[model samples]
Target: MDPVSGELKLFLDREKIRDCLARLARGEDRRDAALIRASCWPDSTSDYGVFAGNFDEYLAWVVPGSPAIPVTQHVLGQSYFEFDGALDGDRACVETQVISYHRVDFSVEHRDTTIGGRYLDRFERRDGEWRIAARTMLYDWFQDSGVSVDWSQGVMGMPFSAPHFSGRAVGDHSESFFAKGKAR
Candidate 1:
C-alpha cells in the first residue's frame, strides 16, 4: 500500500467514525430502533447511569423509556479520537460530549432540565464498516429549572405549530419544523 492511499484510508475511517456518532444521536432522538442498531456492533455493550447491559438489553430499556418523557433532545458536542497500532489496528477510541435536555409538564408546575455528559466509546471496523463495540456514559453536571418563559410567546406553544389538536411532537424531524435554527 502506498503512503497516499494509506492517508486517504485514515481520512475515510475518521469520517465513518464521526458519522456513526451522529447516527447514534439521530436514531435516539427519532426513536428509530433499526437506525440505532446500525451504529453498534452485533455484540456491543452500553453503560448509561441507569442501565448497564448488552446492546439488546440496552435497547429494550431505552426504547420504552424515551416515549414516556414528554420532550427530550440529545445535543452533540466535540469528539476526540485516538488511534493505536497494535493487534487491534482497526480499533479506535472516541470521547464525545453530549448535552441532553428534558421537559416535564406537571399539573402544578412545568420543569425544564439539562444534563451534560461524555460518551466513551470503543469503535471497531468489521468488513470495512465502523460501529461502536462498547459505550460508557459519564454524567458530569445537570440543572433543572421551573418553567419561567411563556411558550405561547415564542413559536413554541402556538396552535399553528401542531399538526393535530393535542400539540406538536418533540425529539424528531417533525418537531424541527418549528425550531429556531436553519434546517440541516
Candidate 2:
C-alpha cells in the first residue's frame, strides 16, 4: 500500500477504536446492553476487580440495575494507543483515562463516589471492525462525596422541574432522543 493510504487507514482505525470506547462508556451509564455488546467481541474477557469473567458474564453483571448503585457515569479522557506493528495492525494496546461517578444508595445514607481510573484494553480488528478483545480496569484514586444531591430542589435552588429530561438507570431522556432516530 502507498504511504498516504496507509496513514489514512491508521487514522480511521484509531478513530474506530476511540468510538468503541465511547460507546462502551455510554452503554454502561445507560445500562444499554446492545451498545455495550457492540463494543466487545463475543469471545472477549473483562476484569473489573469486583467482577472478572467473560463478556456475557460481565454484561449480565453490569447491564442489570443494581439496587446499591442506582446511577453511574463514566467520563472518558485521553486515550493512548500502541499498534502491534509500525503500520495499522489487527491488534493494538490502548490505555484510556476515565473518571467514574457512582450514586451509592445505602439504607443509612446516600453518597456519591468518584473514582479516577484507567482502562487497559487489547483491541482486535475482526472482519474490518475494531472491538475490545480483552480489558482490565485499574483504579488510581477514589473519593466519597458525602450526601448525594437533592434533585427535587433543583440545581443551586433554581427550581428546574423537568422530570422527563432527568437521567435514570433506564428510560432516560437520552433514550427517547435516540428513539426518534436523532442519533447516528
Candidate 3:
C-alpha cells in the first residue's frame, strides 16, 4: 500500500507539472502574463540566453501586454523527470523539448525564425503544488525563412475570422481556453 500510494502521488505530481508547462506555453502564445506567471513559484528563476533573472523580472521583460515577438508558437514535445524523494516528493528535475516559431515582419517582407531547444528545469512542489524553481533554456538549433501571409484574409478570400463559439478571441476576453470552458 505504501508503494502504491507513493507511485500514485508521483504520477499526479508529474501531471500537475506538465499542466503548468502547457499553461506557460499557452500564456506565451496568447500573450497572457497572468497565465504564464501562474506556473512558477514567487521566487522562481529563468534563463533565456538573452536574459537571466527572477520570475518577476522575466515577467517584466515579456509580460506587459504583448511579447516582443508579435507572433509565437511553442510546441511541447516530451518531458523527462528525475525525482528527489523528499517529503511529499517535493523536488524534481524535468527536461523538456520545445520547438518555437517567431514571426518577424518589416512591412516589406515577412520572415519566421524557428528554434529547437530544451527547457531544463528544477521544480519544487510546495503546498501540494508543483511549480518551476529554476529554468534554463538550451538552444540546440535554429533556422529562419521568409514567408507571406495576410492576417486579414483567408485562403478563400474571406476575412480571417475565428468562430465565436470556437472560443478563439483576439484577447483574453474570449479566445482563451479558460474562457472557452467557462463560456458554455
Candidate 4:
C-alpha cells in the first residue's frame, strides 16, 4: 500500500502534467509563445525525432510559420507518471499520449490532419511547481487530408506562398508586436 504522502504526491504530479498539456494546447491554438515557453524549464532539451533543440528554439519553430488554417486541438490520453519522491529527490518521469488535430487549408481542399504521438518528459519540482525539464517526442502515426498543391500553378492561381500558408491576420504573429515596440 502507498503511504499518504506518496499518494498525495502522485495526485499532484498527475494534475501538474495534465495542466502542462492543456497549456501547450492552448498556446498552440492562440499562438501564445510565452505560455509555451513557461511550460518548460529555461534550458530544457527537446528531441522531436527530425529536430533536436532547446526549448527556445522549439518555440521559435512553432509560432513562426504555423499553418494559417483553423485552430488546432491537442487531446491528451491516459498518462502514466511516477514521482521519484520529494523526500528522496524532486524528479519525476511522465509518458503521455497526445492526439492532435490540425485544421489545414489546401488549394483545392480544406481539411484537418489527425496525428498521434507519445511525449516522454522529465519533470522537476522547481520553486514548488512542476515544470518540464526535458521532453522527447515519438510520432506514432498520422493521417492527413490527402490534398496536394502545385507550386508551379500556385494552387488555383493564388499567389506563390508557402505550403503551410493560410494568410494570417495583422498583429496576430509576433512580428507586429516587435515592430510596434521598436517604432515607439
lDDT of 2 at 127: 91
The true-structure Cα RMSD of candidate 1 reads 5.0
TM-score, cand. 1: 0.79
In angstroms, the error of model 1 at 153 is 5.8
lDDT of 1 by residue, 1-184 (tens): 6778777777788889989998888667656677789999979999997889999997786564544455667888988888676433689999999998777666566678889999999999898899999999999999987773445555565544543333322445454544557665
| Candidate 2 clashes between residue pairs 3 or more apart in a chain or in different chains | none
Ranking by lDDT: 2, 3, 1, 4
Question: Which ten-residue region of model 1 has the weakest summed lDDT?
Answer: 162-171
| Best-performing candidate as measured by lDDT | 2
Root-mean-square deviation (CA) per prediction: 5.0, 1.6, 3.3, 8.2
Give candidate 3 misplaced runs (Cα > 4 Å): 65-68, 156-177
Give the alpha-carbon lDDT of every model. Answer: 0.77, 0.90, 0.79, 0.72
Candidate with the larger TM-score of 2 and 4: 2
TM-score of each: 0.79, 0.95, 0.83, 0.70
Model 2, range 1-184, lDDT digits (tens) per residue? 8999988988898999999999999999999999999999999999989889999999998878586887788999999989998685799999999999999889887799999999999999999999999999999999999999877677777877687644667777888878898656
Best-to-worst ranking by TM-score: 2, 3, 1, 4
Model 3, range 81-162, lDDT digits (tens) per residue?
Answer: 9999653768999999999987766676766789999999999888888889999999999998767465555555676465
What is candidate 2's local distance difference test score? 0.90
Question: Which ranges in model 1 have alpha carbons more than 4 Å from their true place?
Answer: 86-88, 105-109, 148-184
The deviation in Å at residue 178 for candidate 2 is 1.1
Which residue window of length 10 is worst by lDDT in model 4?
163-172
